[model samples]
Target: MSSMKYKSSEEFHDHLLGAIEKKRGYHLKRFEEHKSEQDKGAVDALAWAYTLIKFGKGNIKK
Candidate 1:
């Protein structure tokens, strides 16, 4: 939901780092789930959704 747009890898990387920092169960689990995705688009979409959940619609950029 972030207004800030990110490249796919950027989204994934940010979420992964955020997960590490926050240590939220779902965030960490989601990061791992997305990490194993072989399709780039699926991974990107997963990252985008996770970023939205972690950062909200306008609070941060990926």
Candidate 2:
């Protein structure tokens, strides 16, 4: 028996997409806040988040 809330693969993908979008928003805010400080890690995180979002969106379409 699975304890997961999503019962279908599409639902699971949607959940993942929502999670990634939330995290991407966080990373974007962090990058903005630390931009003036030249935070390398923040920039990298933001870039990775964007990449993940793009990949997720692409996968969800198929």
Q: Tens digits of per-residue lDDT for model 2 on 1-62?
A: 87677666677767766776676567667668776444546556656865776566646432
Best by lDDT: 2
Per-residue lDDT tens digits for candidate 1, residues 1-62, read 76655577557567566764454444446657676444444546556666665665345544
TM-scores vs. true structure, each candidate: 0.29, 0.53
Q: How many residue pairs clash (N, CA or C atoms closer than 3 angstroms) in each of the candidate models, in the order given?
A: 0, 0
**Per-residue lDDT of 32 in model 2:** 82
